[model samples]
Target chain A: MAKRDTPMLDELLKGPYPSFVKELYKVQERKPMVQDLLGQLEDSYEERIGHWKHGGIVGVMGYGGGVIGRYSDLQEKYPAVAHFHTMRINQPAAWFYTSDALRTLADIWEKHGSGLTNMHGSTGDIVLLGCKTDDLEPCFADLTAAGFDLGGSGSCMRTPSCCLGKARCEWACYDTMKLCYEFTQEFQDELHRPAFPYKFKFKFSGCPNDCVASIARADMSLIGTWKDEIQVDQAAVADYAKGGMDIVSDVVMNCPSKCIKYNGNGIEIDDHECVHCMHCINAMPKALAPGKERGATILLGSKAPIMEGALLSSVLVPFIDLNDEDEIEDLKELIGNIWDFWDEHGRNRERVGELIQRVGMATFLDGIGLDPEPEMVSAPRDNPYIFFQDEEEEEDDE
Target chain B: MGTPSIPEIAEEMFQMVSESMGKKNLKAGDLTKAIRQKYPEVDRKTCKLALRELMDNGRCVYAYFGGSYIQLPHKEGAAND
Candidate 1:
């Protein structure tokens, strides 16, 4: 955008409050519209008295979703961007977009919106920000005509996102794209309807690497992993050793559990002691690979702060065989149970993480009808890491 | 015609919106017009409330424009997941 005559913004540029808008404008790859909006807001600082009111129900056509309500307090002053709503177009699985498709999306948005877009947010929605109320239908029409639909907003299930798993990554233990797409289709009502106490997020990672950081962000997390021992290729190991790679110092010694032994021929792993950190595999990729047995580990209650502090999702199910026919069904049933329990007991605006915190893990476990395993205990109070069965040992000692 | 209850009018309005649009979006004004034929005694305020209830219950969406519009959200003609 040709620098508009923003007298008020110029004045604020000299202010002490860090001048974030100016700083943003200084960025090399900034979108001009965003800078323009910031400039507009700065120009009419006095006219904009307060924040715009939101959270009232708003949407369009046969669906109970798509449109997000937005407005500017300075509607009278800035008529062009008065009721600037946000439209969340559902991003493709792993955001695989061709250049032509991307250009089409940009063209459509420019036609309907103020040309302000957030490529993708943490929730994985292709967010088209700064849209007018009247342009909702036309914008949606153009978008849908071009084969795009909206994702969830409001108190409903937010968009389900996943990492690039089977598409490109060899470390992927399961098909993240299939599961992500299947679940998105399967849970349409959840995606659209604002029935729950608060928004729910589902993010999937192909493996423990958690490139998407779903463990700390998603309300529910699915991580791919192998159930069996790590596979060690003896030939590759010998090749690495011959190629000036120090197996004893690098792989064996650096093992978190020290379960790896460099037998001078091949490395031996104490299967039970392996932590699945992927460190050895990453360091010596040619020599080691994930085991054949593959599935996912379900982690629950991950969230960012609203009521409580941010938390990583705790392991709910250590190993779920995603390959099994009944496993997906079981997973769905588990999700349903969790939702039911949360719906019945969750306070308004409280996320699933906050709900679990308010009611304790035992209650959550019972609510889902899952028998609490020792694996579920993220932290232990006393010693005896190995022989942890029940409270009987503590009682006996007492 | 006698006045219809909020829930009755809301349900009917919801149905009208669904049938009227099929997959397309329905303006809130359209529902008001249709609802008036059946329940002439209902005013815009009450109709709006009923509409709000429907929207909240996931029957419809607000359409998120400067003004209120109700539409039955559908999953058609969109990109594949």
Candidate 2:
């Protein structure tokens, strides 16, 4: 194949920031498919439209997902990249990896793919950008032999991801890595097969800080929290005072709930009013810490913009003991109930959040066998109108 | 009637796909519901296993027209474009 001119793409290389095109140029020598990829992208830029087409059946044997089929409409023009499909490989819990493991993946990709990879896709899968249909089974075989597997795709339970919890962060109240790995193992069938009306995602954050952004992205979000009062060390507070830290302006005034009072000597926090926002603790990490009683809050139905609009997760269970075995089983049963409801009632391509919105929240709660709690809503209804079931009408029907 | 075997379910699914080739697009959930309606003893897990067998044997393939659908593979000489 001859080199195609890509003036528009070439302009991107002129900037000071490191360019991916430059990296592709380096890999083009080993895998010539990169050259065709660049040429097609250049054509897309020129025409102001993408040339790639989706919707082909391609996967490893016995699997319905993990491989996304793609074809170039300009296949005749760029034959090398005519069948460049993508694969999503499941990442280890918390994305921890050894150098040897990474080398093994690189060797396998070099043998069967275009050698281009996204370190992690949006849903936390290691995305292999381009491969032929013929290479999929062999590549998957190599991956599984090395203790790796493909992540979920299509209408199934997507790869569960979490923040670095007890592994590194002190603010972590639960073992997020352990929970993520356990869920991934327990739901392997759902991960490998299409089992839902549409895609579902799970994300865990070690603390209410929500470093993983689960509240905005996941269908199910588990965020760590504590039940008791905040811990304070007066000596550390004295040291901060000696260092000339402005306790009133920086910590007290900054508390969203105004539950903190800065005495001339030390600071006091009203535990009753504290919403666990973690602002004061963040402002004075050395002087303050989370309480001993720790657990997680479960929220549900978050998603990206689609049929209705974007939505953040809503509080479902105010608090749950993640460390207790029986409590975990209860949580799993709740998850099962939620999936059953959505599978029976959801339309094609409808996310769980959209389904919840289509049916009133009360109906969804009733279907899942959960009682309505004050924490579920952000605010009470302003209007006084209420509808009650007529007991006389029900008695007559019976 | 006795519980339907995996191969039996796969055959039924293949026929469903064949009959609905161009008229309607069927999803995996749709096929599972239809199969369960026929054989009440078959569970969701077994239904999925049957679908897998159908794909592995090239009896049916998944097509993505806006969303995923189960359908028969294209015949020879047909243009994918």
Q: Which one wins on DockQ?
A: 2
Candidate 1, residues B1-81, lDDT tens digits: the string is 467888988999878777766465445545666776567777755775676678767766554332234556543221111
TM-score of chain A of each: 0.84, 0.94
Those runs of model 1 whose alpha carbons end farther than 4 Å from true positions after fitting are A1-3, A6-36, A41-54, A62-64, A379-398, B1-81
The iRMS of the candidates, in order, is: 11.3, 2.9
Candidate 1, after superposition: displacement of residue A237 in Å? 2.4
Per-residue alpha-carbon lDDT of model 1 for A89-172, expressed as tens digits? 999999999999899999998777767677897788899887765678888889889888899876677889999999999889
Estimate, for each residue in A1-398, the C-alpha lDDT of model 2 and write its tens digit.
22668888888889999998888878887787888998999999999999888756677765667888887888888787888889999999889999999999999999999999999999999999999877989999999999999998888889999999999999998999999999999888778777688889999999989998898899999999999999999889888988999989989998988999988788899998888889888988999998989999998888988656888887888788899989998998898899888977889988888888788677788799887665675212122211223554588799
True lDDT of residue A342, candidate 2: 91
lDDT of each prediction vs. the true structure? 0.74, 0.84
Give me the displacement of residue A395 in model 1, in angstroms.
11
Screening candidate 2 with a backbone cut-off below 3 angstroms (N, C-alpha, C), the clashing residue pairs are none
